[model samples]
Target: MTTLYGYYRSSAVYRVRIALNLKGLAYDQAPVNLVKGEQRSEANLARNPQGLVPVLESDEGTPLSQSMAICEYLDERYPEPPLLPADAEGRARVRALAQLVACEIHPLNNLRVLKYLVRELEVDEDAKLAWYRHWIIEGFDALETLLKRELGTGDFCHGDTPTLADICLVPQVFNAERFECNLSAFPTLRRIVDNCNALEPFQKAAPSEQPDAG
Candidate 1:
């Protein structure tokens, strides 16, 4: 059976869960509690030297890491209900939007990075919150511009159906909401998120519904 090693609220892990659910794949979850430091344990380290989660173990026993890579692998392996666009240009657009969040915005705000800023760099709570909100505002503003101006956007980020962009967008939205980032300015982002959440696959993969969520 396929198995996913992940933390409940991790945006990266959330991406894979959405991908798996969208693909109608059946997989067992093996929760890795990042908050409690289980991700650094030997067993986890053996599976992923980076000490991260959302590791997908193939039924044949190969392990995969990185949320975007995992989602692309899933798309290639199970093409039905594809998470990418059909044309090369369309696919590139989706990937560019996805990476705008996954690469540009997410890394600065991940749990480990925040912990280092506070514990190591001695950033106070106010500064921490400021850092968080700053990134959200900067990223959301640009994303809003792109979504509104682009002809590719339809009912969802790229088209009527969810694609890689939606998968990345939803989790980043979750993070922003959790931090109480003001979202009134991002009407298009909000609209796409609403459309995505209306799907059963997206609803089921939500952080609140995850087995390990507190």
Candidate 2:
């Protein structure tokens, strides 16, 4: 069996859940309790040196770290209901969109970075929120423009079918809404997210629906 170690609200973990659902794979979930600092526990650190949620363990004897790498592993191992497009150009475009969110948006808002603001830099709640909202708006604006202007977009981020881009998009949108980022401007992103939610797999994988959601 494939075992996923993750925290419900962790956007990194959220990405893995979306990939698992999209691939139509059955796997067991083990909540890592990120807020409680369990991710830094020896057990978790053994699986992921970065002290991060979403370390995917396969029965094949290797546990994977990094959500994107784990996602690609699933894509290669399963090879059905493909998560990437067939054509090379389409695949690159999809991966690019996914990277724009996973790399550009997520890294800045990481929990450790936020904690540093409060503990070291002495940032207040309002200032911390401002920092978070600023990044979301900037990232989302660029993402929305790409999605709306690109001819590849249809019912999903890359095409009518869910792909790597949608896997990255949904988790980021969930985080954005959680932080109360005003999303009224991104109609295209909202439409794609709404379609994703309408599916059982995506809905089932939502943070609120997870076994560890609190």
Candidate 3:
């Protein structure tokens, strides 16, 4: 069986879980407790030198790193309900949307960055939270405009069905809400997230549903 090495709350890991569930793939979870610094253990380091949660060991025993890459791998390997669009243009748009969050928004607010602020820089809790919310608002502002104005957007980020964009969006939104970031301005984003959470795939992949959620 395939196994996922990840933390329950890591957005990157969350994204992978959603993709796996969407693809109807059954996998085992090998929790890497980020809070306890288990990701840095020699075992995990052997899996991924970057020491990040979510190193997916494929059924063939091939280890995969990076959430986007893992999701694309699953999409390619199991093409039933495609995660990307059929057309090249549509695929480009979906990738752009996915990267807007995965590359831009998430990197700034990632747990490691936040830890650096508090542990290394001695940033207070309030300031750390301020830093988190700032990037979230900035990114969400741009994302909302694109989603609302783009004719490509339907019930999900790119179309009526979920895509890579939706996979990235939902996890980032979950992080934003966890930090109490004001999301009233991003109605379009919220609507898409609500639509996503209504599905069983998204529900099963939620952070709370993970075995190590406690």
Candidate 4:
């Protein structure tokens, strides 16, 4: 069986969970408690040299790391419900949208970065939170502008069906909400996230539903 090594609330792991669920692929969860520094354990380092959660070992025992790469691998391997678009132009657009969140927003606010701000830089809690909200607001502002201006957006990020963009968007939105980042500015993002959360695959993949949530 496929196994996913993940932390319950890690947005990157949550993204993979959503992708796997959407693909209708059954997988076992191997919880890595990031808060307890389990991600740096020898086992996890062997699975992912970067010491990250969400190392997906395929049924054939092929271990894959990095959420975007894993998601694209799944899309190619299981081409039924295509996560990307058929056309080259559409595919590029979808990938751009997904990257806007995954690259532009998520990196600065992930657990490791936050920890670095606190432990390494000696930033107080309030400053760390300010740093978090600052980046979220900046990224969401750009995302909202893009989503609103783009003609490709439908119920989801690409078309009526959920695509790779939606898969990435939902998890980032979850993190934004968790940080209490003011989301009143991004109605388009909110609507897209609502559409995504309504789906069974996305709901099942939520952090709260994970075995290690508590």
Scored by CA lDDT, what does every candidate get?
0.94, 0.91, 0.95, 0.92
Candidate 4 segments whose C-alpha is farther than 4 A from its true place: none
State which candidate has the highest lDDT: 3
TM-score versus the correct structure, for each prediction: 0.98, 0.98, 0.98, 0.98
lDDT score at residue 212, model 3, on the 0-100 scale: 95
lDDT of 1 at 197: 97
Residues 1-214 of candidate 1 have per-residue lDDT tens digits of: 6999998899999999999999999988999999899999999999999998889996568899999999999999999999999999999999999999998889999889999999999999999999999988898899999999999999999989999999999999999999999999999999999999999999999999988889
- Model 2 residue 86 CA deviation (Å) reads 0.8
Candidate 2 versus the native: TM-score? 0.98
Clashing pairs in 3: none
How many steric clashes does model 2 contain? 0
1-214 per-residue lDDT for model 2 (tens digits):
7899998999888888988987888889999997889989999999889898789986586889999989999999888889999999999999999999998999999999999999999999999999998998999999999999999999999889998888888989999999999999999999999999999878988999999889
lDDT of 3 by residue, 1-214 (tens): 7999999999999999999999999999999999999999999999999999789987589889999999999998899799999999999999999999998899998778999999999999999999999998999999999999999999999989999999999999999999899999999999999999999999999999999999
lDDT of 4 by residue, 1-117 (tens): 699999899999999999999999999999999999999999999999899878998657978998999999999899879999899999999999999989988899888898889
For candidate 3, the per-residue lDDT at 126 reads: 95
Candidate 2 Cα lDDT to native? 0.91
lDDT value, candidate 3, whole model = 0.95
Off by over 4 Å in 3: none
